[model samples]
Target: MDVIVIGGGIVGVATAYQLRAAGHRVCVVERHATVAQGATYGHGGIVLPTPLDAWFGPTFLGSRRGIVYRPGLNSSARRFAKQIAPLQAPDAFRAQWQRLRPLVELSRDAIASIEAGFHLEFEQREGVLHVTRDPREWEQAQSALELLGEFEMLHNVLSAAECAEVERSVPADPAFAGGVMFPQERTANCPLFTKLVKQVLDEQGGVQFLFGRAVESIRLENQRAAVELAPAESERKSTREVDVVSCDAIVVAAGAGSKPLLERLGLSLPFHPIRMLSLTSPIAYEECTPHLTVVDSVRRVSMTRMNQRIRVAGAAVLQPEREFAKPLSESLLEAGTALLAQSTHDWIPGAAKISAAHAWEGMRLLSPDGLPVVGNALHPRLFVNVGHGPAGWGLACGSAKVVSDLISGTPPSVPPDTLAALRVERFAS
Candidate 1:
């Protein structure tokens, strides 16, 4: 089968890579002049399991006796506990737990395969220490932390002293009561990984990329799809009917743009645009920057050591599209730097100059229910593997494979509801 993947972000690139590997003649069309220039460019780069699944369960919806959805709050970890207080009935949270457990485990296993197959060398680390400033907050997470039990990563509850034992870089002071230590989580260079995948795809003969041109619309016929491509630099305004290619299958992995395409297909995809920020700073103190990832529950920031630097990122702002530019502003750069200064100072003691820190941003494509809609939607040939929310990077590898299986008409190992849940038809009725 010949397929055209409509976005060149991590998901699209990975999907194209898999499609070609599965013996499909594949062509990926990206709106940007370069690949991974969109949200794929500036992610936290952690290949994590899907942390929680609330889309189909009671906790995911706002019922008379139950409420879900909290905005402008700190870590989901903190709010996750409080929200379930209302849906305290038996097996209420269980429905969500059953749905989430498999996706999370699948995401982890998929990432491991990507790492092994490609010899993907990102500054991969094994532990994510989430330090909290309040004892009460840490206590709250204890009861609601049952969701993560499915993963092999040991979530060690620690006292401040015990936390200091694992990473001495952490402050032992009472500023924070304790932390949760995820001994198996890791982080990587997101931009570098995307580039490497594209490189590998180019080395093989079955794939092609059409960059710098934006897709204006698609033409669907006989259960097949074709897109009208407008050249980015051309002023003549002539559209090219995408080269002799019969788009046997179409995968819309265009991040937020996936919503608009859904509308064209008469399906309203419930999604929100959430903006996030990241800063890359040179490693000033080896002791301060742990070989592990760290999430400061107080500042709502996460720190992970990268190839040559440490990346500190966190902060979600959901506003109008015009208001959110999808990149850090001049004002945000100063505020974010100031926020990191204290944490870095506390963690990396006696550090020298911490320069070369740069800021970037990306808009997270969030669904009404947090889980991404993957597999087929609209036409059977029109597939979707997007809106994985903030966990896209962590879940990309498996999502790609699952998408490829759908394209090949093969029965996937993933549970059937995962596919059923992905259908836009579920939300239709």
Candidate 2:
């Protein structure tokens, strides 16, 4: 089958790679001049291998610290609230986890397969510490601990002193109430991994990347999926001609920019836009720098080590309709940056030169239930793989594989329940 993937971020690239591997002709259309120029570029590199990470599981949407909502009345906000309400119940959460864990494991294996095949290095590092600050914070994590044990994932609950032994930079502050160390989980450079994947795909000879082209519309052409493309917004306005490209199927993986395209086809999804920020700082003191990534559960921040530098990222600011279309607000920017900086200072003080940090902010579209939408939607030939939220890197590979299998009419490697959990129809009223 021939497939046109509408997006060139990590998810789209991964999908294209999967389709190509399955002996399908694949093309990726990206609005930017290059890939990973959107949410992929701004993503935190941490990949949660297990369901215990803050970004995964049912408790994710319930965390006030992770999702900071600006005051406003909007349909999307209401819908988001409605969708997450049921997830707060213990039974509902476990059921969702049953559907989520398989995909998480599949994606982890997919990453390993890709790494082995290409031998690409993307600043990969192993292990991650999910740290809690106080007794209350630690107590709130009991559910996650229970889930980890039930799943039999490799983990160790560490004392504050033991955390220091594992990561020399972390001081034994009294506020530190220890952490759950996922020895098998790791972090990697997300943009670097994406670009490397694209390069590898190009070399393999079955995939094509059409950059600097904006998709103007989607319509049926001769019983097949087709997209009209014009020069991207960044391009010169002199080029007015639109190019029509048709394929057997179309997979929309355009991240926050997907709403308008899908809406044009009469499919309205609850895509709550959340502003996320990431900062990269040079290491100030090598001895003080953390050897692995550290997630501050209270602050909802992730401080990861990528070689000589540290990448600190977090902030899930829910935007109202009025603010969603505009640039990130100044107050929001200051607050998010302050939180990240404070978390970095708290966990590994003086380990990074925060004053000279490079930062990025991107709007991330999160599905109400916190799982990504990935399957056939309204039209038979149209598909979607968006709303992975901040865990895009962690789930991208598996989501791509699932969508590719669906397009090819192949039985998915995962169970029917896993596929059902991510289906776009799951949102249907």
Candidate 3:
């Protein structure tokens, strides 16, 4: 079968890779000159499961330590607050975890398969330390620890000294009461990994990439899905010419850009865009540089070590649609960047050259239910692989394979219940 994947971020690239591996002809359409230029570019890159409760419960909504909502309360914020109320319960959280765990596990396997096949390294690291500053916070984490044990995830609770010993760079000032360490969990440069996969796909010769082009429209032509593309380069003016690429199927994996493209097809998904910030800086001190990903469980910020650089990422800002349309001032963006810097300094003081950090803000599309929408949409040939939200990297590989399996009429590796949870029809009223 022939497939045209819209977007060239990690999700789109991984989807294309899976489709190509399934013996299908694949083409990835990207608006940027290169892939992973969007949310995949500067993410936390911690390839581990974050506790489900972190997105909700008493701490998430109004807490300055977590996501920040801008310009006052909006519909999206209200909806998220209301929807996650039930998830605070242990039963609800467990169910949600059960639904998501298979995909994460499968994603780990898929990553391993890719690594073994290509021998590619994207500044990968092996473990992640989730830190709690005080004893009360560590005590509050009992339910989460129980859930991890229930799921048989490999982990160990580390003392402050053990955490410092494990990470080497986390300073003693913050004084971690205790922390959970996922020794086998991985971290890697997400954009670098995507580009490497693209390189491998190019070498294999079944996949093609359309750079500097955007999907102008989607239409069904003679029972096949067709997409009209226009040049999306900043320097290029609008052109009358439109290149139509027709294929047996089209997968919309365009991240935050997926919403508009789907709306063109009369499909509305429950994707809300939350602008998140991150800052990457060179390591100022080698001895103080973290050997693994370190996450502030309270602040919900993640600091990852990518060779000589450390990326401090967190702070989700939800705003109105009109606000999203207008250009954001540098000062406002810097405010969010400052939050990351503060978290970095709090955790590992003088560890990074924060003055020279590259700040980034990207819109991450999140579903109210927290599970990604990944399967056939209203149209038979039109499919989707969006709304993995902040867990895009962790779930990308498995979601891609699931969509590919669906398109090819092959049985999915995950069970039917899990597939049902991810399909678009679940959103129907």
Candidate 4:
């Protein structure tokens, strides 16, 4: 089979890799000069299957800090707020979690397989500690902890002293309370992983990458998918032509960009681009650097160590469309770094000194129901493997395998009901 995957982010690259490995001819068309230049670039890098709670859950909505809505400040703020209202219900949250947990477990297996089979190296580490400074926040986390237990996930509920003992880099702050630690959770460098996989895919053959070329449009013609490409460096001359690539199957894994492309094909995906920020800086003190991922639920911030660098990420601003040039506000960055400081106050000094150049702001593509839309769409040959939200890195490999299996006419590793839950037709009502 000849397959063309649009977008060169982690999800696209992973899908292309899986398709090529399944003995199909694959090509990945990316708007960027290199892969993983989008949301996968500077993510939190934590692969936590146990923490399967969606952002729209009661905890996040109750906190009122996970999402910030500035109606007059943005054109789409009001509509975006309305779109997310349905997901705020307790039943909606539980349903999304039920659909997410299996995918997450499958993702864990996929990651393990990739590492063992390919000997992949991406500074991978194990363990993630989700802590809270406020006692009320800690109490709220009990439901999530109970869910993890129900899933038979390997985790431990720790007191403040226990948390400090487990992660010495965490400060023994008096405000700190008990938290949950998923011992099997892992972290890796997302960009590094994407680049390494792309390298392996190139070496393995049967795959091509069209970098610096944007997918302008996609349509069905002659019972096949036609993909129109615009050169990364376009000219105003009328003589220039739009390049069209025809394929037997097309997988739309373009993250936030997927909605627009699907819209051209007459499919309306309820996707919102939530903007978030992350700051990466070299660890000032080796001993002070956390050996595992540390998540402050109250602050809605996460800090993870990537070799010598520590990445602090949080602050979600929901937007109706993707914003590429919008920079991170100083207040948000300051708050993020301050949270990092509070998380490591007793252990690290001067932790809030990250330079502006090291900060990154990217949009995470989220579905209305808080679950990704995968599998075939309205068009027969057009498939989708996007809307993983902040869990892209964690869920990339599993989603890739599922899409590839569907394309190859083979049985998916996940259950049939799981695939049905992710199908594009679910929104057809």
List TM-scores for all candidates, in order: 0.83, 0.95, 0.94, 0.91
Alpha-carbon error at 235 in model 4, in Å? 5.8
Clashing pairs in 1: 288-348
Which model, 1 or 3, shows the larger lDDT?
3
12: Cα error in model 2, Å: 0.4
The lDDT for every candidate, in the order shown, is 0.66, 0.82, 0.82, 0.76
TM-score result, candidate 4? 0.91
lDDT of 2 by residue, 166-283 (tens): 8887888655788888887889999999999999988889898999888989986557889999866755577777889999899999998888899998998877777888888999
Those runs of model 4 whose alpha carbons end farther than 4 Å from true positions after fitting are: 72-92, 234-239, 320-352, 355-357
lDDT for model 3: 0.82
- Where does model 3 exceed 4 Å of error? 50-64, 71-74, 232-238, 329-331
Better of 1 and 2 by TM-score: 2
lDDT of 3 by residue, 1-429 (tens): 999999999999999999999999999999998999999997788774656234543334424466665645556566665665676566666787788888988898999999999999888888888888868766766666778889888899888888887877776665668788988888889999999999999999999999999898998655798999985565357556788899999999999899999998889887778787888899898877777788887677889888778899887776765577666667667677777787788787778899998888888887777789999888889899999877788799999999999999999978888999998999998
Give each model's clash number. 1, 0, 0, 0
Candidate 4 structure lDDT: 0.76
Report the C-alpha lDDT of model 4 over 28-107, residue by residue, as the tens digit: 99989899998999787876445433565556645755555445555565565666666555556566677777777777
Candidate 3 residue-wise lDDT at 332: 67
Q: Enumerate residue pairs that collide in model 2.
A: none
By lDDT, is 3 or 4 better?
3
Best by TM-score: 2
